[model samples]
Target: MSKALLVIDVQNEYFTGKLPIFNRDASLKNILKAIEYANTNGIKVILIKHIIPSPEAPVFAVHSYGAEIKQEVAEQPHNLIIEKHLPGSFTGTPLEEWLRSNQIDTLTICGYMTHMCCDTTSRQAVHLGFKVEFLSDATGTLDLSNKAGTIDANTLHETILIVQASRFADVLTTEAWCQL
Candidate 1:
């Protein structure tokens, strides 16, 4: 089976502006290692970029910066970039077709917002019949409020890891992922 590394939403917006609690350096290091490993081993690497609508405008307005993938993880020449508008990378995107065309059956995922984009994409990949290995430490998220109440960023991060481990994907640390 062909395997690929899916690097999701490692953008400047998450690192600098509004939601900025991300561990930029460490996540970059981990993703770089994974990228290098994939390059050396001939494993395909797909980079998923989330393009959220601009604030206070139409829900479909795409900001230029929000559409950019962070420089740190954008180094690979062979990497394929998939722009997504929804939380799930596969939603309304060519991700499934790309994976099919490339014959990718296993996906090693690492990127931003553990409880949102990353979580949604990982679960969607699983549902689409791909084996998913989620790099836990390489994904980060911010706090969110809902009817259940507010959840802190750190707690939400850990909760997603726990939830994904049980039902969605195999949650592995960067070290463990590298070993695979």
Candidate 2:
């Protein structure tokens, strides 16, 4: 079975400055390991970037600097870059076509905002009939606040990982992923 590594949204926004997550440096290290494994194993590495358009200037929206993939994860000519406007990488993107063209049946996904884009894309991948594997340690999110006050990002991240593991995909650590 053909397999691909989908590195989703390891962007500048989530790693540095105000929007930084709790344990970003460690997450980036894990993601880099996954990328290195894909590079050595001949697995296609597809990097997904999320673009959120500015509201005031709808037509000419300034791409959020944080939205850009972090320099650490930038393309190295051999990797393919896929731009996505929504939470799910496959939605409104050429990801499906590219996967079909490359005969990719299994996808290993790692990215930011564990409860949002990463989880959404993993579910969608399964729905679209692709075998999905999520890198547990390679994904993370910022703390979220609700009416009940703030929720720990790590708690939220692990909760979603459990949910996805129970229903959608095989959520594994970077080491487990490398073995695959």
Q: TM-score winner among the candidates?
A: 2
lDDT of 1 by residue, 4-94 (tens): 8888888777776566745667777888888888888889988888766665532223665645677767867556888887889999999
Alpha carbon lDDT of residue 22, candidate 2? 73
TM-score of each: 0.89, 0.91
lDDT of 2 at 37: 89
lDDT of 2 by residue, 66-173 (tens): 666888789543368988778899999989999999999999888788988999999999999999998999998889988988888989999999999998989999
In order, candidate lDDTs are: 0.81, 0.84
